[model samples]
Target: MKKLMLALAVASLSSAAIAQETYTVTDVPVKEKSVETNSFWSNWFISAGVNYNAFYSSQEEGISKNPFNDRGKFGFNVAVGKWFTPGLGIRAKFDGVKGVQVNGGVWSPDNIDFDYWNLHSDVLFNLSNMIFGYNENRVWNFIPYLGAGVIRNCSQNNYMMGANVGILNTFRLNKRLSVNFELSALAAPKSFDGIGYKASGNKIWRGADKVFTASVGLTVNLGKTTGFRKAVDVDALMALNASQLDALNSALAAQQNENARLKEELAKKPKEVIKTDYRKEYVGAPRSIFFNIGSSQIASRKEIVNLQVLADAVKADSNIKLKVTGYADSATGSAAFNQKLSEKRANRVADELVKLGVSRDNLVVEGLGGVATLKPNSYNRRVIVDVVK
Candidate 1:
């Protein structure tokens, strides 16, 4: 029962992870990231779990009897599966069931013990991730499957071909380990149970027999440790690229026009006039370096331009120094949490400035935790840069 509860908790978390897109960088194109190509070993998994199974004979009335009365019928299953894509996969499984207790009602007044070994192949669908969108950090997943296989009934000394449909809930503990809770129903022929349904004392009916099972187990993710490729939002990235290209074109056109205007003005003036030393004043707004929530990486490439500007300013004047302060959103995190997040954000920006030729001694870096906020929670995840002279 404890295993079952743990599985449930993990499954819940996986569902929530699927719905979050926090790492997605808005207003910027996604950088090139590696993805595992489709290959023989790309998306394989292996699992072993303990199962509790109940048998249903056709002779029973009102669907099912007390499942717990025969709850002692425990089983184990081992399976290997692979995903061809994020949505679909196939698995081959072997199950050994024991002491499946059954009561003979009306047809006989005795209890029977059932046991079987089943070898099955199933096609699986990742329903949870499909609807919610795939998240690499997601911890829970829901998979539903349908399968068919041959079952060897050891107690009855017979064999039967059967089909099963079930849902597998996976709670990822980490990249390599996950807990699984699955529930499935198996349908087989009554002959496999050594029970023949009869009409008026003559054997005439052969409807489907039933076996229900619930299992909890751990799965070792094989092949790709992540078991999935990080999904790229192609549409969003393309839109960002188009916007940047358009801005570049507009800037080029404006510069050309400005040069033409300057040439016309110079042509009108005396070319022999004495030239005087002139200094162009550089004026710009302070920059905000944005980061993803819970991330300190220098993610926004656009921010590099801002850092370059500060580097130039500081280089031109040894007296000039820049202050960098980082912050985290308090709406979702604690003070201790925000403090660490803020510190990382500040240091990351400072490191980037240093790499861009600014001296570390000329920069004042501070992690203000959740103190300064420009636009509430989401916008608070940032590092601000101000030049001081």
Candidate 2:
């Protein structure tokens, strides 16, 4: 009993360790747009991967002649999940796989090829804390799951209660489709029966069986709704009074007027004019650039300096409208915290640009706290200065 408890404890710890490591191991790609949680039901995922399993029983050991050993195997699963909330979801899956040989013993009159297959159900519990602990919001791209169900050993048609712990790394191939890579370990406390064939007569054996396997597949989601999509709309939400909205509108109008006046003034000033009619005919220089930093909002001094240079460049281009976009790295903090950091970063950069003579209207600032981005790159941390003519 103590050994069984110890094995269970170790398995739980292993599950937690792998769960913590999933986000750290994968590179989160950028999301070009906002994702709506209400639309989660629209997606279906199919995955194939290899897994390593360990069985818990003495009977399983005698039959296979190998216990607690790692076996190479392959498996595939299909799942449909729906997000009832941003961090909570429910998934139903059907998975099947065959075990690989782990022992090096020769197959003679005494030794026989050993393998097992299973079909089971899994309930997914995503570790929201792991997703919120990273510096990049792309942390959501990696989800760790724990599930319990009944396993049927196809070889002998025996049933056993089992549990699985795994990590899934998903790549959004598009809005409704994604590709998944999974690694898992399923544990069953049962032994392989019917090991000795007609030559030696049938006998029951008990032992531990370990299966290690891998697969790749795609998910397609349907029935999507955009209502649950949350974007940075604090200013809009904070406008409690009609007078405040009117004031904001007036301020926006005044800023636009000021921008127009500055453009006219610069056009008349020969010193500020660039003599490039051909350049004017082509696409205008980018007036704004956007960066998606994975879950962190802390701006380094270097980033500040880069913003300063950007502000200076915007000041030099009188016709430019600087749009500063602040992004959080994959979800590492509370939603509220990420949102605040994103807005603060954007506002900080905007305020600095304002000090450099860029009118507020020319700077459209916004924060996308949950926007995902490519991992392992600094390009996600950025400010776009579009020189809009």
Model 2: per-residue Cα lDDT over 246-289, one tens digit each: 75577556655655554555556635533334333222333223
* Residues 132-210, model 1: lDDT tens digits: 7655557889999999999988988888798989999999888778899999988887666677662233433325567
- How well does model 1 score by local distance difference test? 0.72
Off by over 4 Å in 1: 1-37, 60-64, 101-109, 197-206, 225-239, 253-389
Candidate 1: worst 10 consecutive residues by lDDT?
274-283
Report the poorest 10 consecutive residues by lDDT, candidate 2: 192-201
Q: What lDDT would each prediction earn against the true structure? A: 0.72, 0.50
- For candidate 1, what's the RMSD? 16.1
Model 1 misses residue 72 by how many Å? 4.2
